[model samples]
Target chain A: MSMERAIGFVVGIVAAAVLALIARKIVARRGGATGEYDERQQVVRGRAFTLAYAVIMVYLAVWMVLRNVELPFFNHPSSVLVGILLSVTVFVGYSVFNDAYFRTSDRPGTYIALIGAVGLLNLILGIRHWVRETTLEGRLLDNANLMVAAMMIAVMACVVIKLALDRRSEAN
Target chain B: MKNLKLKSARAGRDMSQQQLADAVGVSRQTINAIEKGDYNPTIRLCLAICKALGKTLDELFWPEEP
Candidate 1:
């Protein structure tokens, strides 16, 4: 790889790590020192993880088969990342529906706001990339921000729906 | 397979599902699931719920034979 590409990759990794730490701090401050899942939530989360792993394995198998079919979009480097994001979305959706996505101390409102903000930001960046694209080859497939935006927005929607269902059930 | 005994016990005390769940360190949904027979709690959780509701495990979780 070129020196500039290597440097950019390293910088991206550092930025991601720093952002993760900041997010953790913010969660700890808003919730508690640590979000504590009850035993039932823990069990549900374990099952969700297993299901997500199975999804990733299935996606990778399909991806391998498609890679040999001369599809330029499927052959993009971001395809693997797409598989990971798909699995993550599955996990999040499952956990949300099962009431295991948020800990007892977690304020779902805070998460909803945070996810909405992040999703909007990624959507803007992804739309910019899409609108300015000149090549038809892997234009959508190579845009990782769009995938991230979609995943985040989908997760947010699932959480919101679950919360609404829970509230209605509680009232009834 | 619903644990109506546990539900009645909790209601007899005028405690909401959320209150009992907080006392037992579980989510309200967990308590709801237990009462609805949607999910079975482990023995440890059963014990915790029993303690929180001031009832014995047999009173709350023991299945009644037909």
Candidate 2:
């Protein structure tokens, strides 16, 4: 790989690590002690992870077959990212419905706000990249911000629906 | 079968599901699932719930012989 690309990759990794640490700090502050999943939630989350792993395996298998067929689709890295996003969506959706996504001390509102903000930010960046593009050459999928925005939106929707269902159940 | 015994014990203490869950260090949904028979908690959680509700494990979790 080129030195510039290697440097960019290293920078990306470092930025992601810093962002993760910041997120952990925020969660710790909001929920006290980094927020622990209860036993039942831990069990449910484990099952969700298993299901997501299965999804990723299936997705990769399909991707491999498509590659052999020379199908016109997202580029290799973008395709792999799509598979990852799909699995993450499955995990998040299942966890939300199973009441395992949030910990006991977590306030769903805080997470909802955070997700909304991040999604909006990514959406803006994705839009800017789309505007600068001129051809249908898999450029859209290559925009990682768009993929992240889509994933965040899906996760937010799942959380909102779960919260609504919980409210209805409580009322009943 | 639903765990009506646990539900009753929690109610008897004038505790909401959330309150009992907080006291037992679990989520409200976990407590709800236990009451609805949707999730079977571990022994440690059972003990925690029993302690929180001031009930014995037999009273809250044991299935009565038909």
Candidate 3:
């Protein structure tokens, strides 16, 4: 509720939105005459998503349990960011695992894995206050870890399900 | 677990992944993925591959069930 925390949250949201918009534009540009998410890609993505969703559901259960237990540890803004980064890393990790198991050769799996790992490490440092938590006027930063986790889950689920459905329809 | 038909047909035709992809109007990466059995091609793309290699769907696909 403090000025600094509000600024940080706002900045995070803005950064996420900007990245999403840029990614959408890139996919759009690649479509040429036909739309991107072609039939094959959709199928591959769907399979990957199903696996990612299953893994995330498991992780979410664990997160909820941990939250309930409340480790007597301080809740920091950095923790929320770490949660977000971990969510991404786990998703991509599962995606790559799915690709390798299914014998899908798309290198996007590798790229996502690498990016997720780096983001995860950064997130951990940020969340632990190792990177320093913002404090101004004695007001605490809103470490919306649950909210961040939910956002990441929603974004990933939407992407995977949409592509899967698209592929199914195209196949039919 | 190998898709021997697809692999042999691709080889018999003297076409590499890049060559097959160029003929089929897809990326070489796509072809590589397909050959590795890491991906299944769409119907349209499967048809394209079939046509390019002078084979039918039954000939290229439809292996014994595992």
Candidate 4:
């Protein structure tokens, strides 16, 4: 209902559109196959999820420490939102890097670009919202949303790095 | 160890990795993984690969006794 959430909902829909594009292509390519993961992919996904979970826990722990130490910027109840964002990044980054999520080729340039562009837009919007907010909690929440954008960009960066490393290893 | 038999049969049939992967209804990377020994395909996929290459499961997948 709020402006920020309404815009966030729109962004979520767009992100989902990108995901659906990849999923539709995959299903079409597989001729309606549902469980396409092989053992190797399954293991990679399992490990990825585990790492994502760890990231969320560690992130929350750090935030708690910052708040306890009375750091000036360590404010706001961001546990739920930022935790969710960073956790998703871990999974997406891992899956994309491993050549498992897209079900398409390793040519992930388009999808990554789309996500990155949208994420930057969201980050700008979050900063604008933060500038307008009067309350500390509201400002903090806006910053958390900005972190969601950063998380998306981070995931994309990790995927690119993984792809580069894999390619180099192959050359060697 | 590589799936040398699968590679050999694919080569004998003059099929590219993409061709075999298409015939088996998977990404080319899946075929590459199978060949690289980094992935073990399911029994269903195994049968599909065997059928695609006109080879039996044992010939393509079974380890040779040293």
For all candidates, state DockQ relative to the true structure. 0.77, 0.93, 0.16, 0.36
Q: Which is better, 1 or 4, measured by TM-score?
A: 1
- Which residue pairs overlap in candidate 3's backbone? A78-A127, A79-A127, A103-B38, A104-B38
Give the TM-scores of the predictions, in the order they appear. 0.94, 0.94, 0.55, 0.71
User: Model 3 compared with the native: what TM-score?
Assistant: 0.55
Give lDDT tens digits, candidate 4, residues A55-78: 989988988888888765556556
In order, the Cα lDDT scores of the candidates are 0.89, 0.89, 0.58, 0.78
Q: Report fnat for all candidates as fractions from 0 to 1.
A: 0.60, 0.93, 0.20, 0.40
lDDT of 3 by residue, A110-163 (tens): 333433443454455446542355563122244344334444444445445544
Query: By TM-score, highest first, what's the ranking?
Result: 2, 1, 4, 3
Candidate 1 per-residue C-alpha lDDT over A1-172 given as tens digits, one digit per residue, 9 for 90 to 100:
9999999999989998997788768878986537589888989999999999999999999999999996776688888998999999999999999999988888888888879988998999888998888775445876888999999999999999999998898799
lDDT value, residue A84 of candidate 4: 76
Model 2 local distance difference test score: 0.89
Pick the winner on lDDT between candidates 3 and 4.
Answer: 4
